[model samples]
Target: MQLKTKSRLKFTIASLLIVIFAYILSNGLIIGDYQIKSLGSITKLGLDLKGGVYIEEEIKGENISKDTIDRTKELIELRVNALGVNESVVTVTQQNRIRIEIPGVYDAENALKQIGKTGKLTFRGPNNDIVITGEDIKDASVGVNQQTNQPVVQLKLNESGTKKFAEATAKYQGKVISIYMDEELVSAPVVKSVITTGEAIIEGSKDIEEAKRLAGIIKSGALPVELVPATVKTIGPSLGADAIPTSKKAAVIGITLVMLFMAIYYRIPGIIADLALAVYIMLTMLIFTTALKATLTLPGIAGLLLSVGMAVDANVLIFERIKEELKLGKSLRSAVDAGFNRALPSILDSNITTIIAGLVLMWLGAGQVKGFALTLVTGVVCSLFTAVTVTKFLLKNFVNSNWIENKKMYGA
Candidate 1:
């Protein structure tokens, strides 16, 4: 009796803790000067969800190879990331055009300035003669100047570039060599000595971030083909404005109905399953907001709802197995253990297959499809844990407590 009392107390404490944690995470907290934003507020929304700018640029060159197109697409992605634009998508579409979607950017001109450059990097001599282009550069990175503790952009040149730079440094020993990107002067560093090692540094950046940005732009290299803007438009948030509230309402209603069904039909075990479901939702959202920093979209919400159903299904499977075990006259504890053991394989088989599909979509799909796959895979994985671990743990504790041992209460 003492052990049962302890088990009951443990279950009560654990359930309350889970509920409290979930509430805090969802609603956030504010105390005096400190504040914590809700998970939903921090989670990034995609172009469709938040509305932003869409740009289509045509590759302006004849006989553009697939490799060139691919390289340009990669550079564009790098440039966008360097601009601190998260959740942006760059894709090579039909008709030799590239499509870019940047969320939360309303100004089309600013967006163009951020990503529309051809990024042609060049080193010009004293008389404005081209010394070398970005093609001869091997790599570019940000480094610190040990003497002044200031940020600098370091450049490494290829063998040909090294020979050319060696000659230029020897000729213009004390003169300045300007670096330009798309005719815009980036830096003008004096040739201190004849550098035969192919290594150079540009030191005039205001801060480390500026130096890193310059390095990132240099590393992205020049676009293989010129890109002409085909279309640039700012997207409105009208769809998202309506979709978000509707999605929240639908989710609440659907989950409430599911919870009610489980509680009314499965009795005590149903209530435990609902608790596990809550934990699953909290865990999945935490992953999206904190761990993955994933961008939520409309399709992603669909994936989330689908995973919720799967979580409920897993609990249903276990409850039905418990009913079968009770019919065989097993004790409540034995039935609970046997039910989980019997249901685990089926649950694993279904969830694992779905996970595999989600991964494939994530690997190959683009834009909204990829978002859907990410959410689906994350939610399914979380569901597996909640169903196999959390629901089982709670049911085990309830049975051990000797609180309700009636077969009917176990859904028999």
Candidate 2:
């Protein structure tokens, strides 16, 4: 074999290896304690599909400012995201009521308990002089006491908080400074001396776990207004289970048709396109399940499907251009190169516009809209990769191997 041919063969083998690795990850193979969770197990499903917790919380007080309501929503979003509920939506209704939907969670009561807390954390001296509030703290973390070997909550103060806390500690040395959560005293520890470093540790936690929990709540920040739970709803996984098979069937059928269309019309090029599309889907699923920590909702599926069409559309555009170039008397390699180059401007313009729209929807939209936007954006990005780089790579290898010198094989 020619050295060049041998190198091409090795490259093909490497490409196949990558595809196999991706397939295993997509299916989530577990080896001993180390496991790659399958896409179904790895990806969470949304409330509409999987049914978890739905909560309607009314903010107390009359005529709450929109700013406060917005702030509350942002805070709730942070809290849910922090709690690993990546797909949860926290939105404000016109009535200023907050609606929260979290999918795939089983412990509704515990979730509610943590989420419902006002988290109005405050640090106060023995004389009840406030040293700082949650807003003044830059960050909170859990640690172990070096001297007493007790679990502690460590707080890092902002500039203003540092000044105030230092003053409080200096003035109230040997007296207790109380840590309050939602106006209830959770701990009171004696101030040892002036804390000039802008850091304080609350050392009365029962254990490291408790200290960590407290730190998480504090990091979520306090709500501007107290929230009273008005209504709560829960859904089971039966809805998701029923929806999956139907969705899967539709997707399988649709992709199969796409695969057939490409292979029939574009011939060998279509087969290469099919392989690229397969890799695109695998990478997209891996990103959705693990990297984004996102759940699949019905609308998310729609987004994925729409993206599949867009991916196919991209390839169609490039293939048509390639055929046009070939008719214009360009060689297969030259036509392939020009096709990609000429098609990129159109492809980028379309995908960029869609991405812009998706971003807008993500910023202002809630629930299903957000899910759709996320999936659409993800799909468009992956499509760009497969349609451009992957397709180009495969075709280049095939051409380099001298496998198809026939003009008819180039869809001529």
Candidate 3:
């Protein structure tokens, strides 16, 4: 029975180690033919750190209305999304100015060319009655018909539009009112009702995503003024290449120093802490890369390193408590249990406060601040798991082994 129990324990530990290893290896070292490994095993690259193109757009239009700024920002975001950059930041600054930051970019001219395109609005009748415009649109959305599960584009009209739509549709029953973008017919909703509620539905959509994009474009409305590019700065791929290596080196050095410090100060418990730390880092990377889809920027890398320091601090507190227990003549196993239980309150308090900071950063901060918030949050969570659960589990198993009788090995 004893042999079987030992074998089961060993199997469980080995399985957990394998799982931990595979998770980290899969994220850090890209496998197969075309996949490339991430530059940071835990550290991710950001746009500013990678040095992408920075474009400043000066909005010069009619009276600078808040709606205009809001609309322009949304349109630019859509355009950026269309370009397939994955992680880009577009925001409005003071004086009718817009800033776009694209990281790891090779070209800026093409983006510049696309940015200035006036998202024009047009409405044509079946007999080419160009009686209305996009300004008449109050709101638009993508929805699904509950009965058929078919996708649709819906447009809600303004007061003036409601009257106009009622008159037009009442007169031309079966005729189509075609919505165009650059002379391309996006939707042609046939006159169904008088549409007095200022709302109309465009059916015949193929999918939900396409319907949503079309709805967003229509709802963005017309630009009050033309957006001209005042400044365009393209950061080359070389810029990213230069900083990536430096950031990687920093991460390696920081984590290695942390591991060494923990081992030296805490003795055998420190080794277990180090292993848990390794697991913590890996779990953090997994959370960012898989769950949040966070773009690992250099600043983000810095935030994660800072969180690592915090994680080690938690272990240190518990270890100090264990040492105190040992001095009181407690057995090694009893010391560990008492130490963790005693330190629990302090660990929770500190981590919870930091998590509050991370939440504030994510809420109020924009662009790079979002990255910082993401890394900090992921780190705190993974660190808690490592310090509280992982270390406890490993220590419990280790204490059960027959050869582990010397209290001195535990710094007793």
- The candidate that wins on TM-score is 1
Candidate 3 lDDT over residue span 1-412, tens digit each: 6844684486468547856685555565445766545524433356666677789899886678885577677677766666777667788875678989877665788888666676666667888877467878888888888878999888788898888888888877788888765454667777766667788787877898778757866876455467888888877667568767887788789989999987887777887788888878777877887677778776787888898888888888898888899999998778889999999999999899999999998887776777788789889988988899888877666766544567767776
lDDT of 2 by residue, 215-320 (tens): 7656656776888889788888888889889999999998999999999999978988888888888888888887987878999999998898788788888989
Q: Give RMSD to native, each candidate.
A: 7.2, 8.3, 6.5
lDDT of each: 0.86, 0.82, 0.76
Cand. 1 Cα-lDDT: 0.86
- Candidates 1 and 2, the one with greater TM-score: 1
Q: Per-residue error at 81 for model 1, in Å?
A: 5.4
Which parts of model 3 have CA positions greater than 4 angstroms off?
1-44, 58-70, 92-97, 120-153, 156-215, 221-231
TM-scores of all candidate predictions against the true structure: 0.76, 0.72, 0.72
Error of model 3, residue 226, in angstroms: 4.2
Can you rank all candidates by lDDT, best first? 1, 2, 3
